[model samples]
Target: MRRYAEVKTANMLMAVELSRRSKGQLRSYSLHPGMVATNTVDKEALWPAFRQLDIVTSDMKPKENGFERWKTIPQGATTTVVAAFDPRLDDKAGTYLVDGNIAMKEQVASHAVDPVCCLLLE
Candidate 1:
């Protein structure tokens, strides 16, 4: 999932750049909808692919705690809906959201919002 993280970082960087360059003409955001139970992934193929990478999933089972549970489709769509229409975000362009809310500073990586890192990506 390293590649996935890389792509997510890039996506947020683009949002920042676009929002800055366009000023008030544009608003952009990046968000992580919580892990949702989707049928899009082919479950049978995922295990073998993980095996090929020597990934040990024995200890990677789903968390049964109050957190880390998968959401249904509707539940997972909450963030997207909020990002698109929430008046509370009127002044919060280029933000990264998690679980339908603005992510706390501690939740984001420093480099993910750094202009130097954005330039390095070019």
Candidate 2:
């Protein structure tokens, strides 16, 4: 996803540049929903393995308590809404977001940041 993000960033930058040249006001942004109890996390292949380990080593059940410890859909939507409408973010362009705040940049996996993934973003 890193590669895809990088490419998407580039694409957003280009779009912003075009908008600027046309004397238009616009902004670009990105968001992350941290530890959201979404299908992507629950249905992942390793989730069962992780849950099995937790059963033996921890008291929490994966479905009932493990992943649910994090944010739900509404909680996750806060960041998305903030990025979309926050006046403080008006001057911020191509900002990566998480939890309604700027996300710290991190090194993405090589595969995630590859040219192929970048194209996928387009």
TM-scores of all models? 0.79, 0.50
Q: lDDT value for candidate 1?
A: 0.76
Cα deviation of 103, candidate 1, in Å? 0.2
Q: Quote model 2's TM-score.
A: 0.50
Q: Give lDDT: candidate 2, residue 103.
A: 59
Per TM-score, the best of the predicted structures is 1
Local distance difference test, candidate 2:
0.56
Per lDDT, the best of the predicted structures is: 1
Scored by CA lDDT, what does every candidate get? 0.76, 0.56
RMSD of each: 4.1, 6.7
Residues 1-122 of candidate 2 have per-residue lDDT tens digits of 45546775565445445434444466766556655656654445645555653421243323445433567889988988997788887776555666898655562233432344344434
Local error of candidate 1 at residue 89 (angstroms): 0.6
Model 1 off-target regions past 4 Å? 48-67, 120-122
lDDT for each residue of candidate 1 in 1-122, tens digit (9 for 90 to 100): 58778998999898777777788578788998986756533366565444444432444333334245667899999999999999999888889999899999998998887766667545
